[model samples]
Target: MLRSIKARKGWTARAPDEDFAGAAEEWNKWFDADPSARQGAKMPVRIAGMKVPIAMIAEA
Candidate 1:
């Protein structure tokens, strides 16, 4: 599934159990290191009423 998502355009497949906080920190560091890295990048979505995004499910 991760590989499938990775194959798609404009999608990033982060691991389910990945340290999200650490990832955020790392992302911030990367952005700081190179401001151009943030260009055209969208912020991650935070869906309310559910931990995971609605799109994760087969049926919404």
Candidate 2:
């Protein structure tokens, strides 16, 4: 996800301020964290200034 965020044009290149990597590491420490959060989550129409990847996931 961070890599994808980095690839976007004009997107700022910086570490996530919320400690995403640490959170992910903690979650994975318990179980093989499912990458399926996108399965049912809705994407915002626009995030910051970019059109979100709404079509990437299934709609609720």
Candidate 3:
């Protein structure tokens, strides 16, 4: 996901004031727009301190 954001044509390092929720929404849009981006991707649930086999980040 970080790689994809960096790979975007005009993405610069996010501003200091930027919030994660806004960025996540934007990235989610990108992820959904391009079907290929989902191939073999396993997104981690970082909001949780401990790793879980299945963590929910967003509503499906």
In model 3, which runs have C-alpha deviations exceeding 4 angstroms? 1-12, 33-60
Candidate 2, position 27, lDDT: 35
**Residue 11, candidate 2: how far off, in angstroms?**
24
User: Each prediction's TM-score against the native?
Assistant: 0.28, 0.26, 0.27
Q: Pick the candidate with the highest TM-score.
A: 1
**Candidate with the larger lDDT of 1 and 3:** 3
- Off-target runs (Cα >4 Å) in candidate 1 are 1-11, 33-60
Q: Tell me the tens digit of each residue's lDDT in model 2 across 3-55.
A: 22312111112233454455455434433433324222233233576532322
Model 2, which residues run further than 4 Å from truth? 1-18, 33-60
Tens digits of per-residue lDDT for model 3 on 1-60? 433443323222333234345655665675555422221223333354543232122322
- Model 1 scores what on Cα lDDT? 0.34
Q: How close is each model in CA RMSD to the real structure?
A: 11.0, 12.4, 12.4
Give the count of colliding residue pairs in each prediction.
Answer: 0, 0, 0
Query: With candidate 2 superimposed using the best TM-score fit, by how many Å does residue 48's alpha carbon deviate from the native?
Result: 25
Error of 1 at 21 (Å): 0.9
